[model samples]
Target: MSQFSRLFWIEWKKLFADKTIRKVVFLVPIIYLTLFGFLYSEEKVTNIPTVVVDADQSELSRELYRGFDADETFGLIGTVPTEEEALRWIDEGEASIALMIPAGLEQNIKAGRGAEVLTVIDGSNMMISNTAVRAANTVVKTISAGATLKKLEAQGSWGDEGMALYTGIDFRYRVLYNPTFSYLSFMVFGLAGTVLQQVLFLGIALSVAQEKEQGTWQTSVATNSFFAITASKLLPYLLAGTLNMFIGFTLLLKGFGVPYAGSTVDLMVVATAFNLAVLCVGYMISYFFKDQLQSTQIAMMIAVPSFMLSGFTWPFLSMPTAVAAIGKSLPLTYFLDGVREILTKGHGLSAVGHDLLVLAFMSVVSLFVAYLIYTFQKRKTAGTQAESTIG
Candidate 1:
């Protein structure tokens, strides 16, 4: 064979010889396509969680409540006594939108004084926010037209004459958190979080794994306590990732003009917890897979799908059960959700208390597991060395 042809033939043989390469070349794309296909199979967001605050208990108000409840776009969980309670439902993630009917709505309509209805949409994810807004508009317009026609008939106006005289009710909708629906505001922060995850995961996935691959893992951790070994491996990556996050967000705020309504202290606390969770998970992967390339590929596999599964672009509540379960297991999901809440809603750590706790818990659990793996491997190595020495 010619020199170039001989080299090509050898390289082609080597490619199929590696199972990881074969999987990446053929199977990864299929898996990713299947995941995303199933994810968007519903095509559009539906059955958005909604709450109603019907301050007016009259039949007209009930009619309006029924209108919202009956709509397929909205799934009204329950009625709240006040708008404050409805807002609480939104904050706690019980609902994505709130419809408020003020007192005397029916009386005001009958008197021709005009009634006003308010819609409040949680705007952290603009996709869901926009869907909710459009659906809310449809429901209000339908109800208003019906009410207007009824009033016009009472006054002896009908058909085109009544339609000409008809004027719809005043419907005001407020998009909380991100009112403008700036794509940058909605998307960039989450993308940055995903980047941070990939960088940390790849960087640390080689930490102990590289030593093990080089036949030095035992010597490196053998003399050091497990705590010291784990801390030493994680501390550098943690600092680097935290600095990366701070600078990245600073640019997003100053350069992109993405608004931050939340407190800096709350942001720092959540960021720290998120960093710890990611680093610990990466450390665990390094301990689990001693091959540097295998560990790196595994990290990439996780980080690549994390952004799509994080529910940054789509609402988590709308995802399929299996997809959402996988998403909930990842640190990026909680971190991105918390970041959006802080940036758009001006919420404190107390408000996103659940997300904060989950990230913290993940960090603790992953770190403990990594330590256990390291200790087990260490004892195995020592036993092997003792046997060889006695022999």
Candidate 2:
């Protein structure tokens, strides 16, 4: 066989034949997908704990309380006498939402005047806050329509005319991209990508570190040119990462029912760039840390915060400037954003060109750095071989 083929086979064995590396490459990703998939399977946030502050004590006020109680998105734990008490409940973490009905609510509605219902939501957790706010708005709109219908009926306009008048301006809405607003769809793809990234980094770092620890790395560097060794070492990881990405996509579409609306070519392009960049990152880690354990530890340290820093769940600009800068330096940030645009928005490669460029840039710069490191090592290894031959 050719030298390149032999080096490829050697690297493949070094990566997959080892039990620990094999598990890190394959098993850990499966576990991460299963765990995070089930965690978000319910699809939507529901049953937010709520407190009602009803000062009116009127039948209309009670009816308003029933509106909140009937909403599946809210679970009314109890009623309180004052807004202050409800505020206390929210402050103490006893409830996520509070509904306040004022004393003149029934009087104002009967007099055909504007009545206000206050919805106070804890904004500490954005998911819960947004869910509670949406549910509250829906409930309030429904109740307001019912009240308007009753007033129109009392005025003897109880027909289609009443509905038309009540629904003035005809506010119709359409939800795009994600009609169901499923948390699973919103979260799963990014999470799976993050896991894939971490696993690939760990596997690459450990494989290189193991070679260095066993003193086999020098021999490989001594025999092959820098380009040949680099290609052979990276090829195994590139293939493995692509396979894992395929598995993740299958699980997303089949197991979790997440949609894939982009071109396969586009997906592959981004995946290839992301894989190359991540492998280079691992290569850098292996070079900096000589010990296998130290390299693995460094890999984990970088992998752990990558998702959070990737701006997947949170807005990138909303993060602290320093934090966002750190996130900008990581390849996962660009990869996840580009994948999301394709998968969720059904955008083509054109929409994600910027992200693709960033990943490509990262790959190029990192590969250059790795090449420089390899050249330095190659010179040292050649000198050692020359010295031994002379002796």
Candidate 3:
């Protein structure tokens, strides 16, 4: 074989030879995909427990209470006698939504005046809060329309015209990006970044540990250029991370019907750039820590917050401005945006050009900085060893 081909084969074999590396490479993807895919698959809000406090002991109030129970979206878990008890249910997580029918609700409806129904929703969980708001609005509108129709019928003026007059504008709701609002489609993009994070962490930690265990890291630094040593350490992981991306997108997403609408080429390009940037981060972390255990701990600490702040589950726009700015600084945010655009909206390269550019810039910057740090450390170590020999 040619010299370059022989070297490549040696490096590839070295990577596969480590039993721990082999197991992690094969298993991390499966664990992440299964956990995230199954947990956040269906987006439907079904059977959320809710509490209703009905102070208005009237037919209209009772009917409204019945309406909530009748809807499949909600289950009436308790009828609290007081507002404080209902609020307690929400605080304790026993209920997601609380309906407070004010004391004069029926009297106000009978007098041709509308009474405000207080809906206290738990906003701590954004998804549940959104679902609760939608359900509450729906039930209130239904009750109002029914009351209006009955009033019109009693006056002998009930007709299509009267109904139209009572309900002036009919609402037509349209959900963008994901028309079906499938959580899997939204989550798959985030999961891609998550898988990349795990792979990068495992690759870097194992690569560093393997070098230490084999004593190759010291031998290589003694014989080769610093640049060559860094490249040898980084290149393999980059290639492995790239391959993992293809496997994840093809097998878990496309094969499983995750509804990819965006340009596949664009998604691949952005994913490649983002993975490289994060891999550099992994290398930097490993360089600072001597052992695999410390590296793993640091990786977990960094990964969890980065994932949460990426605006995958909770929108960045809705967060506090300062918190949103922090999220924007993360590389995963751009990756998440680009992937979602492609998967759900079927966006083209041109549509997500800005995000791709940001990811590319970040990758270049991170790799350059990591190379500098690695080279500087190697030079420092060599200088110290030379001084010791001269002494």
TM-score of each: 0.91, 0.58, 0.58
Kindly list the per-residue Cα lDDT of model 2 for residues 268-363, writing each as its tens digit: 778888998899888777877787877876787678777867767654434555666878899899888777767765668887888889888887
Candidate 3 lDDT for residue 344: 58
Q: What is the lDDT of residue 199 in candidate 3?
A: 68
lDDT of 3 by residue, 1-391 (tens): 9999999999889779975566567756675565444334443665677888989888988888898889877878889989899877865547767888878877776676657777776543346556767877898788778877787788888567685745311222223345455667666668668768776876786677567667676556567775686678778888887888888888866688776656677778878777777776677667676667667866765575667667667654345556667667777888887776566556577767878788777767766776676677678778978999999
Q: How high is the CA lDDT of each candidate model?
A: 0.85, 0.76, 0.70
Candidates ranked by lDDT: 1, 2, 3
For 1-391, candidate 1 gives per-residue lDDT tens digits of: 8999999998898889989888888898998899888787778887889889988898888888889888888888888899889999998778989999999888888887877899999888888888888888888888888988887877788878874864556888998878888888888888889988999999988877778888988887677888888888889988888888888888889877777888766876788789989988888888878698889888998999989888888766678889888888999998987887777778788777889899989988888898888789889888988999999
| Winner by lDDT | 1
The reply for model 3, stretches above 4 Å from the true place, is 1-165, 213-219
Q: Which of the two, 1 or 2, has more TM-score?
A: 1
Clashes of 1: 0
**Model 2 lDDT at residue 351:** 76
